[model samples]
Target: MQSSGTSSQLDNPPSYPCEKLLVKPWGWKWRSSYWFVTFVVWLGVATDLLVYSMVIPVVPFQLEELGYKHPASLTGWLLFAYSGGLAIATIPVAVWSEKYDARKLPLVAGVVILIGSQIMFMEAPAYWLMCLARTLQGVGSTMVWVVGLALLCDETPPEFVGRQLGIAISGVSLGTLVGPPVGGGLYTRFGFRGPFIFGIIIAFLDLAFRFLIIEGKSASKLRSNTTEKPNNEIALEANTNSLTDIGNDVDVQNKKVSFVHILRLLFRSQRALATAFLTFVYGIIYSTQEPVISNHLNSVWGLNSSKIGLVLLAGATTIFASPLSSWLADLQGTSVVIIIALVLSVPWYVVMIIDGHLALFITAYGCAYFFASGVLSPLTVELASVARSVDGIGYAHVYGAFNLAYGIGTTVGPVVGGQMYDHIYKGWLAICLLAVGLLGLCVIVAFFYVGEEPIVQSFTRRIRLL
Candidate 1:
């Protein structure tokens, strides 16, 4: 007969292979895993935005340094090149990330690309080299953004998505807040090389954070004896009952959807299409502000790069409002929050039109940024909801399409805004009017097409019952 110890060993099998069960790192614990991943993703996004914005305040000086006769037009083209690269890379990266079942690799590769682009920017010998650098930067940005966001969605619970996304947006705002001033200050003291050195340092830091990220699947495999379920299988199982409860007819649980089919389904939902359009317009409004505000400070106010950077700081302050807005979206419904934000934005734009003073301009733009921040998180939450309602496999593609729409807006905004600024009378007024019209369209679309029950109706019903 076998000894008691031997029999006990055979009876209680190991939960995981000996080699795989070595030790759990700090991030691998189930309790802290999601938060750690979210923080890393947030850092990656902040670093991308930091690097992108760092170049903005100094663009004019760089053009002049390179002896360009028309820096204004080239600036627009430079912005276009970046957005074009992003538009080209986003969908491909999204598809790649989905197929691989790991976002960590792509995240690292993107940061590596970012580091190389910054080095090129620092050492660029010709205008073409700078353009090439910007394009590479855009590609890196697209990879990070698309993969990072998909990863976040994959890890996060559906109920908390809006708040989590809001937190991510705040991280972005922090980067935007810090980058311009730091870049401009560095340029003022040490010229182009300084900001790029700073960028390289941050890129490495971001890479380190990405390397430490452990996907939930990998963690589960380490912690359990049985082979873990595929992430898609888990996601489908989790969503099936909710989809059925909502009266969804898509049958996404077992379906393998093509990208084109995903697109078709999205378009068929008027709500989804409207969300996409609003996202596009939101991109236009924000991207248009960067070039226009920088140019306005330079040409109209004769401000130095450092002062312009300080002025831009006003916009970043609005980031603090993101969590509050996200909470409001969760409580009041995303549609109601969006409609209220749009209505509030009109007055801010009107104020901008009426005031040319530095203080007034800063205040108006800050308020505009505050309202704009409210739109992004809610809209993203809505888009994700719509995509899941259509096809469980379509979440990654939905985000890809959102990025594509935003990329197109980024390309169009600078080019059109620059041309209008150069050639049209009261060009600022024209841009503001366009913004108003776009906001009106979004409000109408949200009112009629988006399927959320009206917050007002819900409140009224509760009151009637009482």
Candidate 2:
């Protein structure tokens, strides 16, 4: 019989990627596992949005408490500052991520930034300082959103990417809907410092999870022998380094392009541009509801804090649509799903304009929320598809563009909507009209450009069958 020492030496061990280490990382299995990675990304996204919005209801009151006039306007500008930082940081972050192929580091660094911003927001006394803190928060938020989603895409399968992304995006629905209530609840009980303190705690948890994730590529590298690599390992490596290309009209392997050039070509593709516009419009719909609509509900309907929270909570109930949207995207094509959602949502936006019907208004908001949440998955999946079609473009790059579109929407939504609401009579009408117009444009764009073939051609073919 072999001795125990000989038996122990016979077992093959995975070598770490580092020159120094001789074995797989401790906790590598869970740290690099698919579900675990997805959960981390989901939490990463939820944490960012949770904290970003945790102080939403409280911001106006905080400003008023600090003796600032026109608290609504100041709140809008603060959101503008956040969006400004998001817009400004996206490109540089994208470039660096692509160049380095590192996600977790930036993600950790981002959470740290978010923590600092929360502390600043909690302690700052002046309006400009608040703006500065919000801007920093935006920067931190961009890091998580762009890189966290990219990391998810990296770990997921090609066919299931849409569905998986939809699941992750459910975190957005959770964070957005839950944050204000949680914040409002804390405010009711504990006053000014309550929300920020909670935010810091959640962000710390996020930082730890982000630190724990071992990327798929790195984990794959731990296999010292090619024969020892499993199918999953092979698939993961293929996602990054496969010779076979999908898109036509370019030699993907031989033709090298700069990030800017790849981005230009991506935008030139009607499919990508349409999806980007859809994301932008979705951001507008979401941002319009927060400070603007919440304020409207309070001012017009005389809603107390609890009533306002209930309305937003009602809106979030349809988050179930996210999974259905993802499945529809994978099955029928994302373009079709987006088109259907946008069409169904139009009436709801129109319905929100009616002032006399609280129950009806609540119904409209919930319907609108369902469709809005549905739209995000298809847009996310579509953008990833676009990036795959082009050579030298990565998830990081496209997601940066994604963040850029969202930034513009969030920035313009509040600033312009707030201005119209504050300075103009019938400003609610203007905001409604604006949302309706953007939705109409998105519908047309998706019909023409969001699919493998224009949806009108499919319609024409179907008509012939009839």
Candidate 3:
């Protein structure tokens, strides 16, 4: 005797024994809370970065211990290997995750792979094996990053995405803040195997957290109905929907869900292209000077691994600004935030040209790192926005491409920077100049082509009016 509206609204509950006792998953409400999902992404990113940078200071020494000549060059090669793996995996992972509607599966699998990499790095007898391990690390990390960000995009609302992403990205900042000191200290005290053993344990913890989390789509399987009607009632309700439901269905149908089509729609946007470039630069900022920094410090100041880690720590203090930068980008638009951060970073890179003041250099370096870090959240948000603008485009397609750009940057940065440092005259100075020039290029492009409405379009509008 129920109305069609009521019948149509009912969800199908399990018709087994104690069907009335069926309920939503235990603690389902909080496990999928806004912050929890963000934390999972944050933790995933943080763990990967932490594990990567944690071993950086130890790499040259480890190579030296393995009797490899020119450990610095080898260190650069290892970084290149890592990046190459990331680049190689980005497309496949993105395509698969989107095609299969999966996020957590890859995330959990990635951590297990990450743990295997750490163990291999800790025990690998040959240099090539170590390289293979690093490459594997990159492959594993990309899965977490590509899919995790896409998941974040799914859970977060459009208006708040930028800020939430900033918060999640702060985990990268935290990882950088903590990783080096811990790695260096552990290595200095306990040798090469110490830090990675810690890493393995941490990876397991990350795996557990990811396993516990339930994505929104997966949660749809849970039972939430209070009224379970007969089979005839279900039949009657199957064809009926309210006007709002019909409208939503039309909207879903209107969106172009084809992966290739969605990708093409994003590719056509200038802002998305510019954001991808910024992410590439982000990879460069973290990787290029990194291989050289520990060597430069050891040669110039005779600092040990522990002390060098402390120095890197001092320079990374600027990472704290990411949240503020994301908030600003949310408020003022991405172009302004991107421009200001890069411009301020220019003077700091110039400080690298200075000769022999460790404290001063660290201050400048940290300041530069801070400014560079600010751009990521904004770019991430902007890139996601661009994809969202394309009807039916998922976040994975854009972030997959995002990971590819970053992987390329990571590969390009260490190899080029390390080679230049090894052979070029005033190479550090040259690198500084190059960084400044690239920053300028980024600023120019961002001003003209980035954000909600680029400066170029406004200028074009004015000329047309004239």
Candidate 4:
């Protein structure tokens, strides 16, 4: 019985099982390097949140001042253009990184952003130049979104991958919490250049960190070049094959897969993409809420920057709950946790739509987002695992799709919400209703497709509301 119990534990491992759990191990240990990579990648996430949150609130007003009425269309296009860059670059970046290294991409992107910001400073009067600058930032955004995530997957073991991802995602949440208040304050005080200046400083810092702290060989194939190998082993291998034979073998191995091959692989399996579609829908709603919610408070409630920042800060504080969400993902599973999170959001949206007082509104909406982002992390982890299973190179493409969904939401939300505010309900309720309805759709999708497991059983058995 004791031997059987030990065998069972070995077969179905605990989520946090580590070096101490196992008696025999087959691989070299590198905990310090893993943590270092995690820190650097987390910083990259910080850069993304800081830069994006900086511009979103102010972009519409900036465009409106340029005598561009009906600004929503232009805003939509600008966001789409940024996401478009991410989409177009995703597959190509993956392919390139297969033959090269991804470590330098973030540093390169930071340099571009710095130069772009400086140019924006020089050409502040031109609207098109501002668009160009944003596009350049988008290029860097794509790199951080893809490469940083891939590194997380490479660094952690399978059981702990979800938790590690949760930690990394928390950085983005921290940035979200910090960026808006800082940007809004700077905008209130320093005018248009405030956010851009902040981003430029962050870009420089990110570049320096990437160059100085992160070693290339730790995360790249460059290590393979330095490790010593037996000469006789190499000679026996070379002697076993003719030059032409070796060339043919290499050619066959390196043969590029067709786009259809990739599509088929993803659709044929149950991996990230299946779960990612749900996330794509959730992202649309979540992205729309950010700028629109703040805009609503400012336009309707007459809130100042400090008050608005406080409102946003309330929502941002939900980040503190991410580790708890991650724990839930481990104890249950991502699929079950996602369903619960989305279900909780539906009521939050309903509350946001109806609540007139600032305190009540922030409390309700913040609670929703707090739970919503919790769901978001597990969903991303499952999606990344999906891509990793399908093809080692498809991770960025998956993220590109995810980003594209967010871009769509951010792009459309302002325009749609603005139009609703002006024409339909003449209140923020329309946008809130839309968010509620979309979240409802997500719940329906989850019920039908999120699947069953130890995860589903645990959720149903432990947290069953039905």
Candidate 5:
């Protein structure tokens, strides 16, 4: 009986499959390393964003070649189709990630879809086929982002969550920065096929990296095998630590939460709803600017695809500040950082409305982008905190909701912004003022309703006691 029990334990280790890998001289042992997982996730996110954004500047030109008379409306619909797919897929993917043992599979599936979408983009002769391609890309993006982030939170120490998320966001920024220039430059020189070819290469790299990732649970099991303690005892201890660590934020009863249950819990928390709202608003700001700015550059300055991409490089530069913004959130709290960033955005909007020179336009847009990055960098951390505070174990679900908000905004922003520009070509100044007013209101809501204590508040309390 003793021998049989020992054999059973060896065959079926108590740790999750993510824990450890067998240590060979080389081979798959690298899966057990934390840096490997982090790098893979970072690259995955960057590549996903890169492929998506690379098509943006080239969309107008592509539509013209495809024989579409009204490219503006078509462009908005195409953008909307992608975000609609993202929003629709977010919840289902989140639930799957939460329930499944193999988190890497979703990532692999996503990359496969991405590759397919790129192929469609390159070869599709019809408009509907192109829209289908963009929608598939969006679905793939949802899978990668939801699963990748949940895996990152699971593997990382709680204290490092903010910093790590910041790094991930920086990767996204880097992709956005590079995509337009590369896509536009390539398309200008080599036509539509050039950008899609480059995207396929990056997608393959993303796949290989995801396949090699080993989760923390698997790594822990491998380490347990080398320890002096009995295998069963090590398993028990590891399980206990994991439960204790997660218990603070997640009720034991709610461990196996359903998708509907996650929605209910999210709405019940004021902070979660507030964060979701802000994410929605941020999405609007991001998606709205893309078509508007691209169109503006083409119409006003008669800039070609290559030159438009150069102008966009200004906005991309602000993404470099993501680490700093995330560190500030860790130190000062997300609410404080969000409020300050929104306040700063007001003046930038005013500058944009003035519409002076090309240099001025780029400067205003860059400053606006910098503030937007500040909001995005820490937004996920704040959402995670809210989930924990509400006794929720569904990190994937929380982020799924955040993405849903963003996806909705992306879906709506381009359509509305595009229509507004079409009807009122000279009405951008009025639109800027309206956006500023809305941002101001968000700041007020964040200050009053978003419940986290800022670093300044903690200092004040300590001073009062002294």
Candidate 6:
């Protein structure tokens, strides 16, 4: 509930070890519930991504063993199934979380994931059945990601929201970064079902933790109760404030609208709508490229699983750059940084298009990922700012929309690229399509989606942290 004159309060950073975190200047506050929930959610997402990473490398070997002649085509279908499930399930899960308490959603989703992973381990039928199991995993992932994030927001205070979100999302990036090598290593030695078995075990462990991790609601609500009401009661007793003081309290409550109303409003909002568009374009380019990248290295470069794992690690370089990217966004605004990053990504795509040079390939890929990584967090932050007055779950829906779009792109990208490479370019076209799609998306994002407007322009430039 920022003041009308200082809505810049919304953009301030939380107090943390970093000097840049100024939003909560009253020193960093800690609550045990927040830390526990963040850890559980991060672990849940990280494990899921790690399991997914194992599949890209494991799939080709497994399919070959299962008598599939065309591994690439089968791989495409499996990826499509997984991403499609995620896209379809995200909104429904969000709606479910809104209707019920988030506490149960994680527990249920985790159980479903455990069941799906176990099925994947036991019933490694043909390619199609594998896809079905992955699809179920996707559904469970959507539930966990959306519901968990919504719950995180519900439990966090507004002042420290960005920092908390930064820490939580880093877990996702960390999972994606680490999953491939670990999964690939296990698959290299133990076989395809090994990772699935591992994933199932981890999913079960996560399920057990869900019930143990206390919900975030009590902390946020309790803080508000202990701090807020006393202020109101004091003002009422003193009678020192004018009618405007009492009216301000009512205004805050009035702005707190229903979840559906917020969704409808966001859909209608130009800024929010543009953010969604950026998300869609970003998803198509980014997700479409991910599956095939490792395959490309394996098939084109004649690299072993361990070497390909190292190449995948190169993409994770962006992880180190994310906090700096967020800081740049905080300094210069997300819109500017996003547009610049998109423009810079064009040449990186060119490098990917010419994959003969290994150095060039890794360099271009790293740059492309760096820009994407940099823009990712800030984009969500900006969109959240747009819908700040809405329910905490509203932010999750916005994020869910982006994930759904990304899932669609990811589903289509790999299959199409894989088939194209298998049939047409003799393995060259896969990278080509990824590059072209990415560059084209940069154009759209720069010119059509995120115009030359800073998100914090109309708000305060600076504010007292906390």
User: How close is every model to the real structure, measured as TM-score?
Assistant: 0.86, 0.87, 0.89, 0.77, 0.87, 0.76
Evaluated against the true structure, the overall lDDT of model 4 is 0.63
Question: What C-alpha lDDT, on a 0 to 100 scale, does residue 360 get in candidate 3?
Answer: 86
Write down the TM-score for model 4.
Answer: 0.77
For residues 244-334, write the lDDT of model 3, one tens digit per residue: 4588667756653666776677678877788888889878867888788888888878998999889888746655777899999988888
- Total clashes, candidate 6? 2
Clash number for each model = 1, 0, 1, 2, 10, 2
Candidate 1 overall lDDT versus native: 0.76
lDDT of 6 by residue, 3-35 (tens): 853555334423332222212322123433676
Residue-level lDDT of model 1, residues 352-402, one tens digit each, is 766468889889888887887778778777777776676544556677777
Candidate 4's C-alpha runs over 4 A off are 1-32, 60-80, 99-103, 114-122, 213-256, 391-394, 408-411, 451-466
Name the lDDT value of residue 306 in candidate 6: 61
For residue 108, model 5's alpha carbon misses the true position, in angstroms, by 1.2
Residue pairs in collision within model 5 = 18-215, 18-217, 18-218, 19-216, 19-217, 19-218, 19-219, 19-220, 20-218, 20-219
Higher-TM-score candidate among 2 and 3? 3
Best by lDDT: 3
Candidate topping TM-score: 3
**Cα lDDT computed for each candidate against the true fold:** 0.76, 0.80, 0.83, 0.63, 0.79, 0.64
Please give the range of 10 consecutive residues that has the lowest summed lDDT in model 6. 19-28
Off by over 4 Å in 1: 1-17, 30-32, 225-255, 454-466
Model 3 worst lDDT run, 10 consecutive residues: 13-22
Worst 10 residues of 5 by lDDT: 17-26
For model 6 the TM-score comes to 0.76
